[model samples]
Target: MTAPGTDAPSTSAQDDVLFTGVVVYSTQDPEASAVLVSGGMVAWIGPTETAEGLHPGARRIDATGCLLTPGFVDCLPTADGAAVDDAWRASAASRGITGAVPGSAGIREGMRVLSPVAEPLPLKDLSAQGVPLAFGSLGAEDALDPWSWVRAAAHGGDPAQRISDRAAFLASTRAGLRLLDVPHPGALNLGVEATLVVWEPWDFTVHSSDIRTNAWSVDPRSRTPMLPDLTEGAPRALRTLVRGEIVHDVPGALG
Candidate 1:
């Protein structure tokens, strides 16, 4: 039997990705430390020696004095871009966080995410249309297929997955934004019925720009224009500037 909040009951005992060892983060702790991940979620975290001593046959990763932090979480006011909520949950689960909510008004993206598994049913609109469906709306516009995006964003990625392709969605959103002006920092997605909130975290020292706003920046509303808001760029930018490493692989929202 699985323990509470530990691992779900597995009918087949399969070898899963196990991250056992120290973890460094920009939040909760600044110094180097240890962490543990199982089934893509952070099951335990502690000092290096403690985390290391937990399990055997696990992937022993040396933080090598790298900075670790909870994934950057930007609420409504900041751009809660894609590839984060999915990617973080997978890898960061091993570090310490399992799930994070994304804040935005891009419901269409959610639909796209579920399109492949099923015939993209609009759960919400379905109720209105008097249609019954099982499953909730999935947002995948800014979000990419996890494994696909990872490969695309990783070294020698396929150019087809570039952010430029997302410009089409931006174009459509821009047209919508014209009818609905962008919201203020505190109030985003004002006209929209349901907006998703995105939470983004950083792996290294984050800067003011990481969550701060700029002229083109708006808050609380789903990010429009297919491009990441000014604040969204900061996390990936700072991560690289700080450690010369790529945590989320900087899924470029815009060129």
Candidate 2:
């Protein structure tokens, strides 16, 4: 797809693009540090050491000190009556949002999108009951940052009812994709569309709901991929790619 706000030609799907030195957040391979996108699909994911050798002539993007994850899907409406045009899509892509189900579309599809308003819903309880919960901005006029919704869901409401950071992140990403029946449902596995975001480096930790547990859940034994520490504030998106094509890129982010 053509990048928003740019008349420049789009990247050809036949071209190979390799991103190295990134912390890839993939459930299928949590330790992956590099990714190869070929023909608009995820061709490979593994350690950085093997990337260059496997794809010798691929265009390389040095993503050192960055975290790469599936692009977020917005489950809320944009500014009231805002046209879903290139400008709007460009703004959302800058914030790592790749897709959306705005306004009545979400409700019509039976997707539960909770607004970040006073008197929060019982997120943890609803999540425990297999109720798929997705959090969004307070209103149409609110900023279109998915991280804010994640933070609200993870830390708002009754202390006992707050969801874990990981859960909230998934709700903002994979859950929305699944609800919309998007192919592969937000995963970065081989052959899947390479729609993702590269984020500025940030501290990360595994979150736990248990009060007795240590504040930082860094045990490798858990085998859980680490997520950005919301306590330290949200990380900025350096680049956003849709189907292996650059949609938004911050200057000097690839260096």
Candidate 3:
């Protein structure tokens, strides 16, 4: 994130000429322009500005600039269990936002700590260092897996294989949250790993590639693949995918 601009603080954008320049703003529609922002919030909008008595303090900024709308501020959790905060709160705040929320399994207080950090980490040090954590069911090491694997371990457990998926963890977490569940997501320390992969391991061997690839699974912010509209009818991908028939056969169809 670009550091917040350093300049004179403004009580308001109008009346004082802090900076003045052509600015463009947009809406959900790609071809739509809604309101124009001045200092940080939306200022004058619609039909393009031709206002009188422009503020001298206003710095001239180009309106030809493409609008970079902020991401959707998720006010709720994706799953039924806890409240989830965005994964990039720190970076977002560096850009200006003050409020943040996160929700994920085992992100609650007093969970176990496990990780591949070279530095030895105990429970106390992990929490202090803002380490990624999981529920009591999983140690820090288990949380670091493919998204499906993490969710499976976090939500469920498999004693036969000694493997627990995120779904199992999620169930445990929900049960843990019988009272006031402080919903928050865990940390994702991947940016540095990406750097290492780029600069250090250009010639990664098959074994090394396997190790790096096993570093972590794709961390999709969303928990599940959004199915298409049910109203849009069934998808064609389920060829020979027997969905048990309710009636023996449709009125006009052959079995």
Best by TM-score: 2
Better of 2 and 3 by lDDT: 2
Q: Per-residue lDDT for 1-255 in model 2, tens only?
A: 556554423566677989898887777776788999898788999999999998999988888868888888775554353556677679988999987755532343555676644337787887788777665553445536788777777766678888777778887888667766775644577777888888998886677666555344556555566678878678999888888788887765564
What ranges in model 2 sit over 4 Å off? 1-10, 78-82, 105-110, 117-119, 138-140, 211-217
> How many times do residue backbones clash in model 1?
36
Q: For model 3, how does the per-residue alpha-carbon lDDT over 1-255 read when each residue is reduced to its tens digit?
A: 111231222223222111112221122222222233343333343332433233334443332222212211111122442322344333322221222223433344554322212112243344346543432212234322212222333222332222222222222222233213433221101111000000000111111112343234222232221111122221111000001101011121111
What lDDT would each prediction earn against the true structure?
Answer: 0.28, 0.74, 0.24
> What's the number of clashes in each of the models?
36, 0, 48
lDDT of 3 at 138: 26
Candidate 3 local lDDT, residue 253: 18
Positional deviation of residue 12's Cα in model 2 after best superposition, in angstroms: 3.4
TM-score of 1: 0.26
Report lDDT (Cα) of residue 209, candidate 1: 20
**Each prediction's TM-score versus the true structure:** 0.26, 0.87, 0.24
- Lowest lDDT block of 10, candidate 1: 237-246
lDDT of residue 94 for candidate 3: 26
Residue pairs in collision within model 2? none
Order of models, best TM-score first: 2, 1, 3
